[model samples]
Target: MIKKHLIYKKDKWNMLTVEVNGKTLILREISDQWGEECHTFLSRPAMMHWVEERFPKEQFEGSEEEWTAIMQAFKEV
Candidate 1:
């Protein structure tokens, strides 16, 4: 089963953390930039870096496991 959790949402931009077949991914949609930008991240560090750079921690909305997965990536670096 595929599980999707919305981590953040705002004008023309939103992010989703998805779990599928035991793998995790971060997906983003940014309609405000260049007519629309879609991104997918499987790398933990990449996910952590992008989220840390753009969104606030308090804005995240997801399960503890999902949040921990992202933070664990940050700590691994």
Candidate 2:
């Protein structure tokens, strides 16, 4: 089963971790201009930030489904 856990606490954001099979992922909440959480806004610069931090190893030459899955993973929490 996939397990997501709170790894750290912060004033304006949080650090979360998810483990599945033999792999792990770290995620963070993305906020908007008003500090509202917005996930899956691929057209926004925030998405660039998320990609840079969350999936830095990704080559960005894969299918869109890959990105969707990553974003959905964070949203599922």
Candidate 3:
């Protein structure tokens, strides 16, 4: 089975989707202006880098711990 979670959503133009299927995790950045982009991560570090690059902590809508928890969840998967 595949599960998808919306980790962050500021508006229609900016949102992040994390999709998990078995052992594969797919991160998708959905934007109306920039268009949709999909990234597949096989390692924790790569996933972290993509998160930091696409969604900076300073500009994130949630708390720092919330962001950390999101990453931690990814790490566990």
Query: Could you estimate the TM-score for every candidate?
Result: 0.41, 0.29, 0.63
Screening candidate 3 with a backbone cut-off below 3 angstroms (N, C-alpha, C), the clashing residue pairs are none
Q: Tens-digit lDDT track for model 3 on 1-77? A: 98887776779888877888877779888888879999898766777787778557788887989778766655565
Model 3: residues with Cα > 4 Å off, grouped in runs: 58-77
lDDT of 1 by residue, 1-77 (tens): 66555443455354334333345554544444545454567675676677676545666676676666666544443
User: What's the lDDT for residue 71 in model 2?
Assistant: 57
For candidate 1, what's the RMSD?
7.5
- Tens digit of lDDT per residue, candidate 2, span 1-77? 65544432344443334333234343344333334332434233444476567565466544777656655644554
The predicted structure with the larger lDDT, 2 or 3, is: 3
Model number with the top lDDT: 3
Relative to the unseen true structure, what is the C-alpha lDDT of residue 4 in candidate 3, on a scale of 0 to 100?
Answer: 87
Error of 1 at 33 (Å): 5.8
CA lDDT of each prediction against the hidden true structure: 0.53, 0.46, 0.77
C-alpha lDDT (0 to 100) for residue 48 of candidate 2: 47
Identify the candidate with maximal TM-score: 3
